[model samples]
Target: MSASPGQNLFRQPRAVFAVAFACVVSFMGIGLVDPILPALATNLNATPSQVSLLFTSYLLVTAVAMLFTGWIASRIGAKATLITGLAFIVVFAALAGLSGSIDGIVGFRAGWGLGNAMFIATSLAVIVASATGGFAGAIVLYEAALGLGIAAGPLIGGLLGDISWRGPFFGVAVLMAIALLATVVLVEPLPKPAVPTPLSAPIKALRHRSLLTMGVTALLYNWGFFTMLGYAPYPMELDATQLGFVFFAWGLLLAFFSITGAPWLQRKFGTAPSLYGALSLFAVLILIIGLFTGNRWTVIVCVIASGVVAGINNTLTTQAVMLVSPVERPVASAAYGFVRFIGGGLAPYAAGKMVDHWNMHVPFVVGAVAVLIGVAVLTTGHRPLAAADAAMAAGDRHTDPDEVAGEVADEFGGAPDAIDFEKELDHR
Candidate 1:
């Protein structure tokens, strides 16, 4: 039997905790700038479009670099990748903090994205390889880390950003430095892949229909996701601290739903229906925000409420991609990351430009329509998704155990039988 989520969360090896801790600080980078967007614009004498490039540069570079992570890991090994990524984040985050110009900070943030892609791409494999519970437990732990980091990032940023816009950047550098040290001391080195992954693997994975479908769906969904994440703060017009609290609430819901609520939802509605329902609701919410951009309370409520759907989508979409794809898990993940991050990276900058050229309401309107189109795109793969769901229901599923094993080869390098593939399959 699978362990409960609570048990999975706490009953883990020291190495798991070390990587999970680092995962939390790594995810914090996602929302660290939420409360500071306004301050960044004012202090740097930049327009919202220029300030929005922070997200664009960071995520864009991260997206492009994801294609190479598996290749790098296969050659150098996971521990080296993790440490290298962490080192880059510590240096780049500090450089961003110390930057005198918005353009300079933007450049540094791009560097931070490179490090982030390497860390995030490898962290899951390490968690899966090292965690005590089965693969299910490791996934829950990873998602929990994601939730906590995302939720806390804005709060931390708010508290520090209230002092200075640069405070959050420096704070991340300090925290990441600590995480880097913990990783070095606690986690053992992992084995490199017997055959190094090709640079073209992730791109090749995209040729499969189901993988391509989900990737496109994710891309469209991200258009809505980042539009809200990047632009909604401006419409609400809250100060740094106030914006922090608001997004903290949003992230809290997101974290809670991702860890607990998503499974319940999947159990009740199944994956595809749940996704469609959530996407529909998300579209309605974005439309509502666009309709009522002038109303602060309404916009705030919508922003927070959107997290529920976002959380559900995050968990389900990831599962769907894993279940439906035929490629190795690492390649599938890298491919999905490549496509979705491009959309995520671009949306914020587009929203900022839209606001500059069009109006405040236009971005949300575009976001809503894009989300609906994502729902439509998902329909093309319904038959395959249904097959995946049926396979999952029968307790007979398959994932890339070799890839996961490669991720933490040092811990289980000589003990291939240590991983229970059947239990891991069921858990997903």
Candidate 2:
């Protein structure tokens, strides 16, 4: 039997570490430029709307690319897909550093998004395939990696953006290059799937009402999430270094809660109440940020505290999405990824436009309203969520090792030997 999550979480092979390291660096790209948003706006003589395009370009591209990343991974093999994605990040990030204009940086960020999608598409599967821990253990480690990368990104970005806005961009290029080398050396080649994932699979997966309801809910909540991520920095008026520390605290809280607090809350409150509470809390936080836009301390506090709430919501919502669907974890994950990212990508630019036309409070209040609507959207699929909970309590999960191995290999890409994966996932 696999050890406890705490014990096995750190007891992984070097290959797991290698991919986990790459996962960290890859996720860092999500917030790597956050501290620099204001700096880039000022230095480049661009408007907040233009600077917001940095997020728009990156996330929108990632959103669309989610649809195809599985197809790419299935055909090319996992290691190749991971390497290809890493290579793309290394190139685009460096090019972004070299660019002279805001438009150029924004364009390069779009390219970086493509790489980000590729890496995300395969990294979790690689970890699952190679982890010494079983599936649950692998998730703990994966989520931990996610936390560290997210928490560290801003501190690193802050320190570098303290030097120059280009510093964060170049920093990622160098770090991802190191990660790329590690993957090439440590990770063994994975076999291609016997049945390749169709490009249209994720698109079709959304036809299910449970999946679509959850997807729309995710999208709306993300509107609030990214609105804060994209625009709140401007109102704070802090320099890059201070902004870094502020968001570092935020990321730290997010990471901590994702691993510990979220699970505890879910266990105690159950999924629906936990999600509703977290979502309501997050909306209130966004509304607070809007009401207190002129108060830097208020913005800073709400921004940091929102991390706790967001972490809870992130974990629960993800679980709910998987549980509520009849589809495999990956298809559901990809479908969810696509919709949520679209909301995340567009909110920043739209927030900026709203601010320029009306005021700061409008975008955030609107964002909070969007989240409240998400709470309503979530209600539409209450039966599915409850049934999922029932399924889990009855221990009705698939447990046959051969069945799991085949499913893992089929969804994540693997050779025939993957039938021996031995990692029976109770949950994705």
Most accurate candidate by lDDT: 1
Q: Runs in model 2 with CA error above 4 Å? A: 1-7, 396-428
Which candidate ranks first by TM-score, i.e. highest? 1
In angstroms, the error of model 1 at 66 is 0.4
Model 2, C-alpha of 202: deviation from truth (Å) = 0.6
Per-model TM-score, in order, reads 0.91, 0.90
lDDT of 1 by residue, 1-428 (tens): 13444463577888899999999999999999999999999999999889889999999999999999989988898899999999999999999999999999999999999999999888988887888666555666788788889888999999999999999999999999999999999999876655677888788767666778899999999999888888888879989999999999998898888878777877777778888999999999999999999999999999899889888888778777766655556666788899999998999999988898999899999999999999999988776666655555454222343333322222222222433333433433
lDDT of 2 at 33: 86
The models' CA-based lDDT, in order, is 0.83, 0.81
For model 2, the run of ten residues with the poorest summed lDDT: 415-424
How many Å off is the CA of 221 in candidate 2? 1.4
